[model samples]
Target: MSTSTAEGRLLRYVDALQEAFAQEMARDESVFLFGLDVDDHKSIQGSTRGLLQEFGPERVFTTPLSEDAMTGMAIGAAMAGMRPIHVHIRMDFLLLCMNQLVNIAAKAHSMYGGSVKVPLVVRSMVGKSWGQGAQHSQALHSLFMHIPGLKIVAPSNAHDAKGCMIAAIRDDNPVLVMEHRLLYGTEAYVPEAPFEVRPGRARVVGPGDDITVVAISNMVPECLRARDLVAEVGISAEVIDPVWLQPLDIDSLLASARRTRRLLVADNAWLPCGASAEIIAAVLERAGPDAGIMVRRIGFAPVTCPPSPPLEAAFYPNPGTVASAIHAMVRPAAPAWQPDPERTRLSYQSSFCGPF
Candidate 1:
């Protein structure tokens, strides 16, 4: 489970997350993982596979389906000097524990005047799945961003998935790690040893000069593909992934927007008053009216996600949609155009097999 080589091997996103949990749990005795179906054969889409056998029931176990009660238990355990990682299979269900999360876990340290620490990590999955529909496919991380004392991160790749998981476990505050379901099958080179992707930092995934495309969570890969498509038309797009959402790296976003003067934010959720809107507002406020930075955003079409595959495909933003938006902003006078339908189809529509 450890490697000393300088060049780490490629690992799937799910395996990378499992490694993070295994390493951290071994490093500290207090680190433990608990969630519904964690001990089941499926192991939460195989991310928790082998944890039960390796860590035993005491450290890795399953819980009842009561999110509120389980979340409360985790908060209490964190206050009692143990680091707990609570996994919610879907972000949609987190709403059931808002009181425990917003009122207690997020406010404990401040309410206790810094004497108490809530070292807890809540891992949840977002994004569309096979006909999961509105109830199970919602990405509500933005709701938690408004609360104080909570750190939020949505790692889009395997590397950040592992690094951010380690960082969240080590952090002294309550942290929410939002994982995109489709990204679980993605692969990236990752180190065996534990590392931290510090919060409040943004990575420029694709560097360019013509325009800046700030993509969040699952949207990062789509925007990257859009960048490639736009390149055919002589457009260079600079894509940034704000790994940490609560303490967003607005400075990086502002710098890029200032350079390109045309920015588009693609998020995993709706745009109105969500992360995309927040990011666009931050950039505009700093850039000022004289900066002449034109901004736009794309996300779920401001409606409940449809259960049907075709409707779901239309609801979410794809590379074709993203590229079209970017093209429209950068070339307002150009004729209407879009990427090929085959290329624009939902990337995960065919690959993702899910019952969760």
Candidate 2:
């Protein structure tokens, strides 16, 4: 944690996200909002709150529930040099707009050899917490991360949420800003003034000695808690919260991995070809072949993520899960922590498979 003092207001995670959007809109005229319920009483959560009131309908526009049409419209608007911020209610909802995004928005630059810029940011939430079922509960950001020409932004705290989001709004490429449904209520500190959160920057959340634990999405705070647990036992686990998932902050990650000499990455995306695996590869390439890495990613069980709450509790990654992973990472030799047979997307091909 390089931060000696916290800045901005201590507000909820949702407020930090909103503060980013509000500040960006205030700072740049090119930044504008368009989504399903900017004006409707039934908005997708409350992240879009007060924007319609402040910017007026001209700048803050609403669309019908058609994700495809709105996405296509945003792409065209972006090609015309107007920045558009589109919010889909959930990651699943984005499937409806893939044609516009993948075929047009994502391909426009390379398809034309840098002829045009798509300064569009599509915002969506991973709302798996509300028993929203498989459809709504999926952590689908990995799907976007797979696509080229699209940047992925996932912030774990109030400060990065504000900074990273402002960066996304200003970028020329199409970017995806994913917020977890479970994250909206949690609180963190955020600055009031509009500022810059440069893309591809990651934030280290805790200072530790034994190991460096890099966790993405909402798993960040869990990593912090895991650090606390290890500290109780005299092991220090440095925690890093990535503000930008794609165009990742490899420099920050390498610095921390070098300092700690051992790296553990935690993520909610699947294991075979997820964000965690990609980052583990980066660490090894930067830190050398002899670097010690224990990578752990938590996701739904392939048992279709059984709908039971107790089942979810047992299956999903939590503070306890992270604590156990870190403890094993620092252990001389672990015979206890067996590979979880029930988790999603863990494949032999991806484990420790990197450019190192």
lDDT of each: 0.90, 0.74
Clashing residue pairs in candidate 1 are none
C-alpha lDDT of residue 319 in model 1: 93
Number of the top TM-score candidate: 1
Quality of model 1 by C-alpha lDDT: 0.90
lDDT of 2 by residue, 65-169 (tens): 889889999999899988999987777799998899889998999999998999999988775442555676566676777789999888776676677778889
Candidate 1 per-residue C-alpha lDDT over 1-356 given as tens digits, one digit per residue, 9 for 90 to 100: 11112347799899999999999999999999999999999999999999999999999999988999999999999999999999989999899989999999999999999989999999999858588898889999889998998999999989999999999999999999999888998988899889988899898888899899999999988999999999998999999999999889999899989999999999999887899888989989988889999989899987899889789888989899999999999999998779887876555545778675
Clashing pairs in 2: none
Q: For candidate 2, which ten residues in a row score worst on lDDT?
A: 347-356
Scored against the true structure, residue 247 in model 1 reaches a CA lDDT of: 89
